[model samples]
Target: MDVFDRMQNGYLYRPEDPNLGISNTEQLKKQRLFNQTADHTILKRMFAAFGDGSQLRPPLFSVWGGQFVEVGRDVKIGPGLTLVDDAPIIIGDRVQIGASVTISVAGHPVDPTLRRRRLAFNLAVHLDDDCVIGDQVIILPGVTIGKGAIIEAGSIVTKDIPAHVVAAGNPCRVIQQVQVEKVEPKMAKSEFEKMRDGSLYLPEDPAILAEQQIHMKLQYQYNNLEPGDPKQAAMLKKMFADCGEECYIEPPLHANWGGFHTHLGDRVYANFNLTLVDDADIYIGDDTMIGPNVNISTAGHPIWPAYRLKKYQHNQQVHIGKNCWLGANVTVLPGVTIGDNTVVGAGSVVTKDLPANVVAVGNPCRVLREINDHDRQYYYKDRRVDLDE
Candidate 1:
């Protein structure tokens, strides 16, 4: 099948197949299930370090290597959740997740030609604890969600979410505030059991957490080393040894010395080919992701004569809130704050602050729609998942 068919069928097609453009229905279904199960296993093992009490409800799907995926204690996850982590994705205790929620924590360069040149870009995502994410929500990269935030079903989280607020809709807005009470141990156990058995529900694990951490450490080591010098390979190796649980950076490739700075929270992730340009500081909140080829950069040069002469001094700060997603090829400009739980569209140029709980797309990026119960109801009315309390 072609890329579109593969996406629609939720499976990867064989490259050598003569009829690669045709969808293999049976294979697609089987591959979808396999992918979900594999993602669930990876998530289980990765979070296994978090403690035995941590939980994950299955049917969670992801790409290779489980980049930037993190789970919290006593958490619940639902089906059809796609988390693309090239960064970090962190979760807090007692969070509830809904189905078909897309959390991507990575982005690529804005210039198409430069992107083809494998130039690094800068973007990341974060999500705090004690949040409730509704069904069919799309979270973009470089966003953060504060503690005790509630994202209404089908809402798109595009910006930062302040603590203890209820945000929803496309380009999600702060519609109201929610009163949150801690779940007692006994109650927590009961809820966990219900979710594990597929009765109660929750959102998927944020996939950016682990990936971001790995990317940050790799960039830090490379920044301190010499460029194009194989002698410096040992320095990079030693740095990885010292990283411990903070991150995992695979082998370096050509042009791996792009300066990128990333600051991560307690839990983070950075998937394959995650690039950074540390010419500026890129701060990512706890539990975020940086997906494959998900580039986070602060290396843009100014076009004006005076500023251009100075080569656009790299001192800007790109701040990403907790619990967000930066989709594939999503480009974020310098000095931008992606609000918590926000979703940015692929191939988008983010030039300003995106408020929390919204979905945005297109060049120059306009708010496409707000994720809400009405939208959720329209899309998933027939689904068995229960989003409303």
Candidate 2:
């Protein structure tokens, strides 16, 4: 295999390998020229893929120059950007990277002897679309910041952060989700505030309906488009408060608030006729798959007929954790927090909270059983999971 492949695969390779020859000469030359000139045209010429309207200032540093880096459209990269681009560094569209951000993909071997020989490996770092990296943030190897995520200044990102969250600290953790402004405890509450806080409120409040109607217009556009339309993603990003990467909701999505109160995580797939009563909030975590005809609601009304006639409604947030599978015709009720890696059977109504790693079915959704070793060995009842058939 080639030396480049060896480095990228996390197999250590020596920089002084004779067969590789002088690889850094051209990169170094371009790095010097770009930094001195600050001409964005040179940036376009340097990287693997530098999209249109992306700009970067001077004082950029990279060992392999910008050869392995990919910058998407309309990205604003500030000055003093440092890159150890031995592997790929992919920056997605509309990404705003602050000054003095260091992104490193190269790492030395832990073994002393290997370190003495200057053996190194590479792992790619990715910053997804619309993410903002604050000044002096250090992103380590193999870390992917998800779509619309914001990294606080002076933080060190050591792990992959989930989409649409605000993360901070030395080893960054998500301090808060990034959909709406936090309501102050002592502040005067509006009708919208009442709805968000789970108190009885009116959806017909003029201000609230105005925002919902805007989303409804966008949703109408989204639902009527061609099935495989490219516009769906951008529309979802605009409509939802926190819409992550690789999330797909098959059209004919019915949402009461038009997804104004939803936080969708990455790799989430929803089949046709998925309904979201997202009045307060609905957080569907990453890698969760929803079967056809599932209804997840966050809004409810009073049991009393008098309050119902007056259009009194209350909302409770629903939180579904990562890697869950909701079968067809399942209904997840308000205020329920379903844990990670759980499977909800078809035609089940989840009225209460369900724990992780269990199979739940039937009305009011009681736990059928915990996911066991036997289940992994068998794909179905009495059917073995055979690799070779």
Candidate 3:
């Protein structure tokens, strides 16, 4: 069988097969434009089945340029969305997706021999109607979300979620039964005012976008053009509203307002690929060390599909206290506050506030332990803490 047929039927196949990816150059062009501009017309022409009143915030990442994704009517998705659509990704009507969510339809075998041959398989992801997928959620291959299911923040869904249930966690499970009421969102203020006040705003509003575009251009230049540019300081000043002295961020930084909504205290250091979805204020205190691939977001959306279909958005401030260390791949959600001298472990998702002088870690991050005298005595593996030595 051909690679496509094999993938559709859930059989192993080689990804390097010449006939696999989209041969249609026109679709590729549209995909590029859609990401660059968030243009609905380009998105409509790119996907397999895009229905009426559907809205997607762009920078949409897809494997095959949305060729295998069939999106139903009134579906709304937020920014930093990734669709690994090697097989079909079928979305039913009124699906609400949050920011930085990934729906991957492809998986690899565990066997080394199978992997060595560049072998992979595909199983389609199906999202039934009226489902709410929260921020930074990852849905794996062959999973089906039942109608009206609600997956909360920072969930990694590995299996099917039944209808009308609220599910969340590392390997996501049903937490409770919740039927999200379809309440009509109020007529929000001007987009900028609504954004700052944590009310539902549209990211695609013309005036809002016009102002955001200026910062986005600077952000693009900072990420792409300024690899070795010595005037990184100047660029950073232009990017952020309040960038403190001795603060350094490694390149490939992604920000919604180009860090204009963010304020940093002194001696703050961030590693590569720190993404700031700074729709609102993000205050980082002094001496905070952020590890690689950290995502700090201040943007969110309403759970109601009707609100989402209209592409309503909201923002909340994030506050990080002084001397805090966030480990690699930590996702800090909207409206979170991390206390001073706290440490978040690797791969943790901070969905709530963390108190000072503690180590918090998990999918929905919780305090592991307080930073007690044990920490003062031993730094690493019973090694004595000798400052003089």
Among these predictions, the greatest lDDT belongs to 3
How good is model 3 by TM-score?
Answer: 0.53
lDDT of each: 0.56, 0.86, 0.87
Name the weakest run of 10 consecutive residues (lDDT summed) in model 2: 180-189
Candidate 2 structure, TM-score to reference = 0.52
The model with the greatest TM-score is: 3
Q: Cα lDDT of model 1 overall? A: 0.56
Residues 184-260, candidate 3: write the lDDT tens digits. 22111334666888988678855467568989999888887656677787788878989988888999898899999
Which pairs clash in the backbone of model 2? none
Ranked by TM-score from best down, the candidates are 3, 2, 1
Candidate 1 lDDT tens digits, 63-111: 3233335666776665456766434567667676765678875455577
Backbone-clash count (model 1): 99
Native-referenced Cα lDDT, model 2: 0.86
Q: Model 2 misses residue 380 by how many Å?
A: 1.8
